[model samples]
Target chain A: MNAGQQTTRRLVSRTGPSICRSCLDTLSRQPYSTAAAAAIQTEPQEALPITPPTPSPSYALHAGILVSRPPLLTRPPHPFESAYHLYQKRLNERLALPFTRYFYIKKNTPGDLEWKRKIKQRLTPARDIGRYRGYGDEAWNDEVLVGAQESEMAWQVERLLEDAERDGGEEEGKKGEGVQTVGGPKKLEREPVERPMPRVTEADEKGDVRSLGRLLQRSLYLVVKNKEGEWVFPQDRLIGKESLHNAAERVLVQSGGYNMNTWVVGNVPVGHYQHDFVPEHLAKSANPTELGLKTFFMKVRIMAGQADLKSNKLGLTDFKWLAKEEVQKTVDEKYWRSIKNMLAER
Target chain B: MALRELPSRAASAVLHNSRPAVLALRPSGRRNASSEALRDVESSSSFEVPFVSDSLVKAFDPIERSKRRRLGKKPLPPSRYQFRPPKYYRGPLHPHQPPPSSDPVSREFIPGPFASPRLEQTYQSTIASDLMTLTYHHLPPGYRAPVQLQRLREWTGDSPYFKGRPLRPPRGGGGLRLLDPPRNFKNIPEITKVVVHSMVPEAQDNSAHLHVAGMIVQAITNVRAVTHKARHNVVGWGLREGKYVSVTADVEREDTFHFLSKLIDVVLPRIKEWKGVAGTTGDSSGNITFGLTPDVVAMFPEIEVNYDSYPPKMIPGCHITIQTTATNDRDARFLLQSVGLPFYGKLVD
Candidate 1:
């Protein structure tokens, strides 16, 4: 027997008889063997011609290296997808749609009162008798040829009488509440009766209450009277290759007659309104697009100038510097609903 | 005083005072008084003393006495006043006195030395002829030579790509070979677009905050941003379908180049404790996506200007995806390196 087999037999006898000799012999030989001993054992084993066991298919090799191939290279779908395609899709969807450009003209409080007076005088011709005609030849010509008509003179006389009657009624009301009407010394001795004051209108309250003295009170949105006399905000068709805000500024300068240098415009739109393009007449002149017009409104603050808008020069007859309440009442329901939040009182 | 002359002076003073009273008795005094007053008033008013003083009137003595002591001194000559121009006045006093020059004087034209050396016409013509002949000979056989080149000597220029050196095609039939260093990589590869995206949790989705995020993106990129909605619902993550969970702004062309320059020159340097973008940050495609902290996003000058509008607590972190027109990550990395963005780590296979 070999040395390993003899040692295995000794170990097996020491431990127990039933233990397998081959397992013991293999463990002992593998642990104690050096490179030289391993070489010697391999030579002898080769000489004896004991065949080696075959490897499993899982551990198969070809050409002394692993036989597995790399997965076939493929392109991912994402990198080929581009933002330009998405942009084109969005553009196609919005084709043939009309866009509205909205601009707000800032108002000067003091100038607004003068503008309102001028508007009132223009509206009521009969009450503007003392209005300045002109100077020199103009005044002479106006005096001679454009004298007040009989109807206007009669209306003026009627207005004077109405004014006198109102003054007289106010005096009578004051006198009725006075001690003279009661005709008693006791009434004079007693504390003055707390007279119920007249209920003030919104205009009266605005005149009485002082604002916080902020330089800017409210911004004025440019509005033009349409042919039907309905008040509509100044709007222009958005041109190609122009942003909505830029288009609004251009429209304000060209049509609204606002100086571009004096106004400070915000970049982002404050609000937007979308309405169907349904004109009253189905004439060819009217727009016949199926899509609605989407209007983007941006806020602009006036930096300088009197904020006097020249409406007549741009084919608009009249304009008014309206407050939030007046704007709501003047604009259409759909427009008011979209812009009310932007014009809401802070 | 001479006694007699003094008596005569007193007598003359009395006579001078009495004469004016005596004259008042006649109509001449009244006429002269009215006329003198009118002339004097007009004269005085026309030449009014700007600074009037009572002391000046008391100080003046107009009449001379005939006494010996007074006779030595001649009577002060009547003070004459005439208006003259200010002492410092250098030109005409009246506005219309000096008329504007009718003729505008032309400024002399002093031409500076020629900025560059003037080469001889012969030299330029020779070079031009040589260039024409060179190009003509090098032209493909099917193309006809121009008439100017027919008069020049035959000359064929070397290939522009190889300069004067002999043409050396890439070596080893299928192996790689280095070529001349390109001045610009624009033809081979380029940045296609820069996309800025930020995801908001479903529970944290607020339209106002999202709007502010969109505004920030717009401010940073100078391009309008669009809201991205969730495509699929993940019930476990509380995500719902069609819900807005992120915003993105895709910048291209000039804006993409501008953003890249700003990221390299400004934003990246401001990031604290930053190493570099990892080499493995890109996918199989050449698009690279990297996460940025909220503070790092705020470092962009556009957002810094209007930072108050978006409070710090509301500023969310975002991911920036840089897409390049390259086939693979290695090429994309080379492109980014050319633009000054450093990459870290050895690239994984």
Candidate 2:
């Protein structure tokens, strides 16, 4: 038998000892699957055929399936581990490049192979949130963990694959620049199997990964509803009067508590209105004339009492009551004049 | 004796009067001249019979020798006091008088009511009523002082207060203190639909973009003038003419930035400058004047002016004029008086 057929037979026998396909084939032994071996032999035969199939326009349809089926699955990683996991996924998604190859390989060298095992050991379960800290802590375990668990292990694996691809790409680039192929009988020939991948600098990578969370927060607000209609925060959250003193202080805090520079607060009222605290003017028994007449008013003891009523909590601003005696002392000159003029004309 | 006394007084006067005539005669010819006139007219003794004093009477006498002189000259009359004209009165004169007003029955009087309590109260209350009921200001005095607020890293500790400070004198003393400075109105870009509307039939026109742009230019200039006077940026303004109305302002700062940026980037391109405005509502310039206060608006031919501080109704503020032209009709004359020209080109390198 030829060397190729013998090599295939040996590989097939070593690969888990399962043999169902074409047992008598000359090239069945290989590290690769039996199907792979068959495809490789069939490829050459197909390229040089004595009687080829008719060249139909429908060839495009036949080629589509072959082009789409790649070894790598591009579906995103699951996103439900933890908030940090989600954050990392989003970051990666934002930085995803359109074209480039990154892959993992088994290391056989002492320096790389041993270091890979050590790195894997370092990715243990994270015992605490803040404990895990590093540029790539999200993918690997931070200091709190010594070994990766669950999805994190997958992240580590993915990161290692990327690193390997980048290292290979760079090495290929250096080798590519130093050599050139010549077209002559005296020149040695080498097959062009692979070319160097594109370079992605750190800055360009960061730009791709950058996100704007604050911008999104400001641009859109959630609109949740119930049977009653639109939702309103409980009085405590909305007004925060009973819970706070110095109304302005409450305002400052609720408005996103001040940041180092500008307040990040939103939905602030333009000005304070007294109506929130005071009874509606229409509901009061006092005549408009009597209330209107008072020149100076004193806050009634009862008004203070009313201010505490969980139901009637004073609104945005305070309101004082006009004393009965003071209200009587006041007069509406316009009213009297209009009445007098009407009587005189009649 | 009385007659003799009269003659004595008269004779001295007569001698005094004749003194000047005697002096007038030549010293050498005086006796001859006097004798000739006296002798010709009367006896010398008769001339002498004036006062009983012989010496005085002699001064008045005419001599017989004067008769010869009389042939050439008339006799001089005896010296007498010069006739005195009547003395004039100096002080003010009074007409006939009447009795004082204390006579009661004769004096005229005006009778009416005096200081009624009701009237006084009405007046007091009217004066007490304030025109404006609401006002806002910083508290604890000098609230704008830099020391009051803590600094921020991004902030340079610059004057946020400077935004509201007046750029010029206020319209009136104790008038509307501009709490905010003038601001550019938001320019809406991509004006696919241009609508020109006016209260007056004359203002009707199809080229709304031209009218609005011209109005904006005019409004900005007017605001600049008032702003220069009041020393304020036109913080906000509303323009209304009949049913046609527009409001401009930086309601919020971030929104304002977006507005100004969009206007510069988008709306400015569509503006047509040279097109004649449609509708007769405005004069040739397309300026429609409005009032700031109700009272002020009353002065205009149109609009009802009422001075109601509560929800200020009609007040003269600024007039807006819109001038429009087609984009293809661009020329140097299309630009009106504005705070700045609407620049439409690549930013200078």
Candidate 3:
């Protein structure tokens, strides 16, 4: 007999001759419900080995607000990603049925005439959509194509030269000089579309860290100069019996003032930082038992308005909205190491 | 509609294709007008333009023709309006083919998402980073995970045959469940889908129960409910075999975000004495299941807006299972918690 059969026979014999093998099997399997219950759970949040409890020393609890403006714009695509996406777009366009132009543009309308004039200027297929300038390079720097609007630039330059020739020779340039050059064409009814604002704002040009407008694509965090003459997120000593989240909100309003609207993410702190007080600083305090400060950071998202530091409770000298890498350079190394993981990379 | 537009569109398409050849016949005639037109405005080339003739444009009156066709006694052929995607992918070698689903003409194409949900934006913007940071455990470079016991146990007797014999299945007659992978930037949990399922035993006698359940589910989820039949008879539950007793809907993509946000922001708060979801709801894997009572379900805008229409007695309660990308319940719970879901009781993970 096979070893498998032998084990089954021996198991049946061990159980007793009265019990059927199948019944024994089922009885053994009875408690085997969803195996999800069998899986072990390891996280013991309260039992974190990060800090060992000290029997003697009393610690000062501080609440810090990690006030941040989430990314204002999407991160630019990688070179390879843009290329792949462009290839897929082009392939889809090539295979797809032509867009029904008549559905959108009524027959013999100005819009229809304008569309006709556009396609006649170039051999553009109905399927070519958006600013699809024919797949030369899918660069995120808007280098996707050299330009479909090269002819657009040429006309502007042509008009400028025409204006110069007209004014320089005999007449002054008129603002309302209606369509009167070369083969005369009537003005179309469509409004000239406005160009999008440039990505590089004035704040970026002047290298202003205080402006929320700077670094439009990255996560900008608020860091204030503390009473210690060091840059940190605005923090304050916890009030008696105040919860961590309440303390966080209080400290944030006390330090930054109530100019901005903010929402705290949750009741539980996202992270905590602990550091020892200098001997001189502790000696100056009334309480003799206090050893060091433990700051629990609560994440607060800034929906609107800027941090106002004039009504400061913590005596902050300055404030700046800095991106992740900029925060690293501005804040001390130890502080950076402690808080870097919490910042979103954009 | 595509069929009605076909005759005019097909004729124009023919004109567009044959234009270059027409222009090639009179190259000199087309060249001079183009140069004159270019100095100020976009150069209008009559021969090159797709819609050059006003007569052609005047002839393309779909509204008038459609009216005439509708006025006719006999309707158009049944085959003209219907378009069905091929039942099977017959392979690349097959000649007769269906267009890819992404194609506009493809039958399977349902266009959207028309807009990004507010909760989806919030999660992508703020909550995602918090989850990643909170879960991250720093291990030194080149450090390996501790070895785990093999799932299949070796035979205990150490009989010579046991050495190479096929090891037995793990205890409890199941494979090791729910992988607990180390947290990193790459594996941050994001919700995949929310499934709303309602079981209506009353539906066995009256199909109206099933219909009402379906309407409520579809309204809240924005997806059609699929009816399910009981495969086996259960005497105590009064469920007979092949009985239609349940309706379910899978809320996915933008619908999932909208449903979750509506639950968190509106319906859930309205329920009095709500202690929040039980922490033991998750099934070890990243799926968390929780039930809403009939009154709580009715709290949704879909039902509350039209409460009179639904028979007051037959509103079915449903279990919502949120499926996330996380491998374990711990990460899934963290993600849901960050997205404004509250959990009470001892967390199983």
Which candidate ranks first by lDDT, i.e. highest?
Answer: 3
True contacts reproduced, candidate 3: 0.05
Weakest ten-residue segment in model 3 chain A by summed lDDT: A34-43
Candidate 3: regions farther than 4 A off: A1-66, A69-220, A226-315, A321-346, B1-84, B88-100, B140-142, B154-168
Taking the tens digit of each residue's C-alpha lDDT, what string does model 2 give over A1-346?
6566665654454443234233424234332444456557655544543444433211000000000001111122233333345334333332333211111222464434434443444322221222232345133322221122423535445444544333223333456654644642232233433433323335334542122111210111111111234221111222322221223233322321232122211111111211111236525734332222111111001101111112222122211122222122332334222222111010
Clashes of each: 0, 61, 0
TM-score of each: 0.26, 0.13, 0.50
Better of 1 and 2 by lDDT: 1
DockQ of every predicted complex: 0.01, 0.00, 0.04
lDDT score at residue B195, model 2, on the 0-100 scale? 22
Worst lDDT window (10 residues) for model 2 chain A? A59-68
Model 1's CAPRI class? incorrect
1 against 2, candidate with superior TM-score: 1
- The TM-score of the first chain in every model comes to 0.34, 0.16, 0.66
Q: Please give the CA lDDT of all the candidate structures.
A: 0.49, 0.28, 0.73
User: How much does candidate 3 score in TM-score?
Assistant: 0.50
lDDT tens readout by residue for model 3, B101-129: 77756765544453356688768877777
Over A1-346, each residue of candidate 1 has an lDDT whose tens digit, in order, gives 5675554444434443333333444444543344245445455434454446543212111000000111111111131122223222222222212211111112564334433444334222223233323333223222211122322323434544543233223333455665455544231122333443333335445642222112122334445564557666655556655665566566566544654233323343545667654455324433343335566665554334322346423355554445466667887887678767655331
Instruction: State each model's TM-score restricted to chain B.
Output: 0.46, 0.14, 0.70
Please write out the lDDT profile of model 2 over residues B1-349, one tens digit for every residue: 8887998889989988878766667445335632666555554553132446555445542333345567777667866865332233233453323333333222231111111222122212221111001111112221222232222223234789756554543345553321221111121111111122222111223235334323332232221111111222233532223333333321121222232233333433344451222222323322221112223223332121112211223222332232322121121112211112242333121
Q: Where does model 2 sit among the CAPRI classes?
A: incorrect
